[model samples]
Target chain A: MMEQPNRGRANIVGNGSVGGGAYTSVRIVGEGEVLGALGCDTFTCTGNCTVFGPVRAGLFKQRGDVTVKGEWSGGHLKTLGQLTIEGSVRAAKLDIVGQLTAREFVETDNLKLQGAIEVNGLVNADQADIRLYGPSRVNEIGGGRIHVRLSRLTAMKEWLKPRHSTELSAALIEGDDIHLEHTRADIVRGNRIHIGAGCVIGRVEYSQSLHVARSAKIGEEVQL
Target chain B: MEQELISKKDLLEQMDISYGQLYRWKRKRLIPEEWFIRKSTFTGQETFFPKPLIIARIGHILQFKDDLSLDELAGTLSPLQTDIRIGAEELRMRGLVSEQMILRHAGLALDSGQLPFDQAFYLYVAEHMSQLLRGEITEQETGALVRLLRGQLPKLEGKLCELVALRTESGSSMVLHTGGGRLYADERTTIAASIHLDEAIEAFKKKLYAY
Candidate 1:
């Protein structure tokens, strides 16, 4: 049998110029297919797949999905599309566009996203989280509503314990109103913060108001 | 290698810019983290800073962050100087400058520290401060807050509590540790807190969040 060359098939490579709104098909490694080059306008991962080198996409805008049944490390992953996984999500730094629902911890310094972040462990968003889950440790350039599920948390510079007294990080939280669910530190000093019930902060230093809860617990002297 | 000594007030002053500017820029949507220094000595005091470029960076943020909000000014600002926002009243009684300025700023905004326990405003102050600045006098600012509270409940149990600070303005400052809102004291108000003692003396330190 002679080789029949199929025409009209476009092979998109790294240097190839694909038109806008293009849909590229990618084959998963099911029956032992080590897909070396991962380039696409739309990408998806199923079962166990491994990238020998690095994987780059158009920030999920090109539509890339990684179930990551195996291990995905090194480099960066930017998804303008939605990413949903129930596996161990680990990375040096990750930036996503869609929602991030991980069953593990997230440690990144630069993440500018427009989707919600729902993780089980600590979430450290260096920039902003349009939506969030659980307690976080971050150095924010802006302030957003923080939901800390843990009893207590701190940062190298600042934290979102917007209660009576929390620790400091070195960034500023500018919300006319902030809420510290509970307090349990040594000394808390800064600007204006509105605290709530069941808190146990330690050193209650400088701040704005001192709205105490009925069932709240306090330490020693409160200097206002 | 040895680093220079950077004062706490100057460092806080530098952060004041971004914290202030971001508030206006984002319109209460975002705020940056505070600047923190490592507590080298015991008593949770004695911080270390690279004095050469510290104040200059903080001054940069303070200079520019007057109206920039959190989302608008992320990498563009920082707290390098040490100008704390304490009044003259706080400077006199709790006059421990070199030891605990970070602890003083933990309430309102953010402070650059490692621990979060210091962030908790010991419940009493944090809760009250949270409710006080609501533009009205609720049940929160009426009874429990006006007087010094002492109880035998679990709230007062466990650790040995002490409220010793490292940052003071001069002798007086209007510093208030409201529940956990913003931390700002007028002239009569002095920023102070009570703590349950722990083995780690560094836990006693304060971190500056806002100005």
Candidate 2:
């Protein structure tokens, strides 16, 4: 398909609102609200932004807080603070340093998470690299390679402050190669599965190989 | 009517396929999302699939994975993605649809250029149902069925549904409804033939990809 000429740019300097439409780039510096569906090449939010409709962008960068009432589809998304998406998220690459709450599914080609995530639906990614800094929860995780571990910073900060929970809780986790630390799951299935330290898994199903840390607890193991 | 469902655990055991393969196929759209039925079981919530449908789909995937890439397999398995366009001549040459059947039912000439997937799908469904019914339905009724499907299938917007040919003393008519529901006819009317739209589409895809 031929690319259409961009509809221009929309920028919010302070507390402002803009009706959503196709744009070349959207830059929100302060509190901003998009009233309808947004389609843009680049969306950069510095403070806070609330989108009442779906978002389609090529590059989405958020520094503060953003809530999308509808689905969000983008190519490269990097968030430094918090993100709340009521609908599903479909992206090529997602990099988050803070918290993310998605009511629906979150699907990406590559996912890099450093903070926490709460997803009511499945989190499907081709390559998921998660370092939980806080308690995280997901219904199911399925993909090619899934690796979840407690963040190094979170581990080091635990000695300074009282211990804080930094783990991932999932009902089902399935992939080709999976290595999880500080994760609690009902079922873990993969070709090569490694249950790292502080993991409490109900069952482990591996086809090729399996390894469980001495500190990890597993209810059952089956070689498929 | 309720479909028989196989739990995910049981399906894995029965199919001898790993969870990774199943999830990967699902991600690739080889398996439709609607087929994944989640319900609360004794062991919390679990996923289930329509037994016969999932079995057949897994068999098809296993048969083709050796020869076709997952993306190509997805193109054939996914009915929602209908980017395939072919000329009537090619359709005849591939024998996916007989030229006589196309000419008689679709009323399209051999020289009619490239046919979009929707038109081709309508033609395929029409020919399939007519052939199945054979002498049970009249030629006029068959033509009416084809016309009804061609008009209404597009309106359904790719919903998983069924086509039912109904016959009564007065006349014969066709109805399309979402599948998995029992369509009852009064004593006077008889349900002549019923076909699942998804199954038909899968068969059509197989035929199209066979070449």
TM-score of each: 0.33, 0.68
Query: Can you tell me the CAPRI class of model 2?
Result: acceptable
Error of 2 at A49 (Å): 1.0
- TM-score between model 2 and native: 0.68
Reference contacts reproduced by model 2:
0.35
Cα error, residue A124 of model 2, in Å, equals 0.9
CA lDDT of every candidate? 0.36, 0.83
Q: List the DockQ of the predictions in order.
A: 0.04, 0.28
Tens digits of per-residue lDDT for model 1, A88-168: 343434666555555554434344544445555434433333322222223222233222222222231134443323322
- Cα lDDT tens digits for candidate 2, B136-198: 666677678778877777667558889888889887788988856899899999898888998
TM-score of model 2's chain A:
0.95
